[model samples]
Target: MKKILNDPKRFVDEMLEGLYAAHPGMLGYTGGDLRCLVRADAPVQGKVALATGGGSGHLPVFLGYVGRGMLDGCAIGDVFQSPSADQMLAVTRQIHGGKGVLYIYGNYGGDIMNFDMATEMASMEDIEVRTVLVKDDVASAPAERAETRRGVAGMVFAFKTAGAKADQGGSLDEVEAVAQRTLANTRTMGVALGPCILPTVGKPGFTLGEDEMELGMGIHGEPGVRRGKLETADQIAEQILATITADMPLNSGDRVAVMVNGLGATPLEELYILYRRVHQLLADQGVSIHRPFIGEFATSMEMPGASITLFKLDDELIPLLDHPAHTPFFRV
Candidate 1:
């Protein structure tokens, strides 16, 4: 119950206000709706606009990725809640370019339902909309049904690929193809050590013992496959990497982009500790690491955990990934 805030009901509003204040030149809201944050230079004419929406708490996510070379607009809901279809539709109409719009978001039930409705609403106005759901969490479901699996940190890769394609004047179909290809080639797995407290709930979303950790946990405190005593950083990394690599089956000569993301509260030092083992393990397997990103790319408030995402890269994908991208939270 220990949190610093003036009012729980206004948490999301206050946070958005602070965000716009800090980056006025880069971001702004549409029609004064806190749920809709668009780039300062959005609605690029005659180009395909990329829009994504999801719940709050997972910062640097649904909102932070909105800017040049990334998302043109984002619709944000409350913590762990999906945005209303109307809200998503509003952002869609405001940012739709003459070409069309592409919706890239994680694989979640609420998001799927609302985005689908929004697509239909946009169709009435002759604005074409497509979607690419990121389903990379190996822990969410069996390999046979990975498409139904929950999306996790691997979403960041999808955003980069789609955004790069859009930035290069690619058509909506081209952007959709690249996003799907990236999603198909990516795999991720995560472990949780502690839970995050929701601002409104005024308590931890879940609880764990001091010496216990949960394997295969989802970002929103979803149940993991196993719970047991905590292990060393190397051990944890091995477990997660094994699941991801097994699902994807990377060869010795393969190249990949490695992302070791902290859920929220995990420190950079700990993430680097895990990354050290991750790099060594991949090297031992003869897999080459091309570009590595290690930090809080996606998170669940202040949860204590990390996830590993591997995107097997080809020539086209590698270059698109290397393309310059500038956002409020990610610059490369």
Candidate 2:
């Protein structure tokens, strides 16, 4: 792959080193392990500690979300690979406050396995750990089995909602509940127009023709549900919103949070064009938009695509989403 790097074997390490160097005030390494990134000032006593981790290469995700009002810490892994169970345990300990800890991440097989192992390890040390798996991509599974869907851009909304709850001194159970609620209300669908090359493999993980697009592709280049000739942004937007709204029907007078997330390489101008259709569609349906996040909230490593995440907001959710949050990549 054509990338700016020296050693393929040292990709994760070197990438994290650059992340820390670029944002030391917001991120701190633990035990000299670059993978265990905690907020520079962690261990906020009497408040629920929020921690998330999984495969890397998705910037503003596993690492960029670490900071005030976001994640207390995160155990990072190599590109598109789950962190070791021991890594999760270490980062959990670093951020554990007296109130306990909540482990939140996307619903992936490896992530579930590693986080479960970490929970068992932490329990032995008297660290109360709760877990929430974000599964918001509606196109990944039938509505009857939503839990089987892959988590995508919608996970970022979960992080924001739950992190705000923790920052407000919510209990472990309370924080976990809010995160679960966020996931329940959130749904995402994506369209990939191009492929990305992994630094280690030295080639594109997957491929797509110039006139083609894959719908509902996962962040790690996993095959999406369908491939078809590319269409206009409005057509793609309408198709995705139809699936989302069908699965989670929006009622008249209902309010929602909107996230138009770029998969990596899609430019802001294009994303905004997509968002314009989303906003218009929602208005046409009589749904109110609250806190519309229109940017690269979650991303793949320079893949060209975009996803729309609609979070059905309620009274409890609106405040949590509105709470002031300051991270290196996200602020409000």
User: Clashes in model 1: which pairs?
Assistant: none
Question: What is candidate 2's lDDT per residue for 97-207, written digit by digit as tens?
Answer: 888888889889999999999999999999999998889988788888877888888888888889999999888888999999999999999989988777888888778
Instruction: Return the TM-score for each candidate structure.
Output: 0.98, 0.98
lDDT of 1 by residue, 162-201 (tens): 8999999999999999999999999888899999998998
Task: Estimate the overall C-alpha local distance difference test score of candidate 2.
Answer: 0.89
Flag regions of model 2 displaced more than 4 Å.
none
Q: Each model's C-alpha lDDT?
A: 0.90, 0.89
- Quote model 2's TM-score: 0.98
Error of 1 at 45 (Å): 1.3
Top candidate on lDDT is 1
The residue pairs in collision within model 2 are 1-202
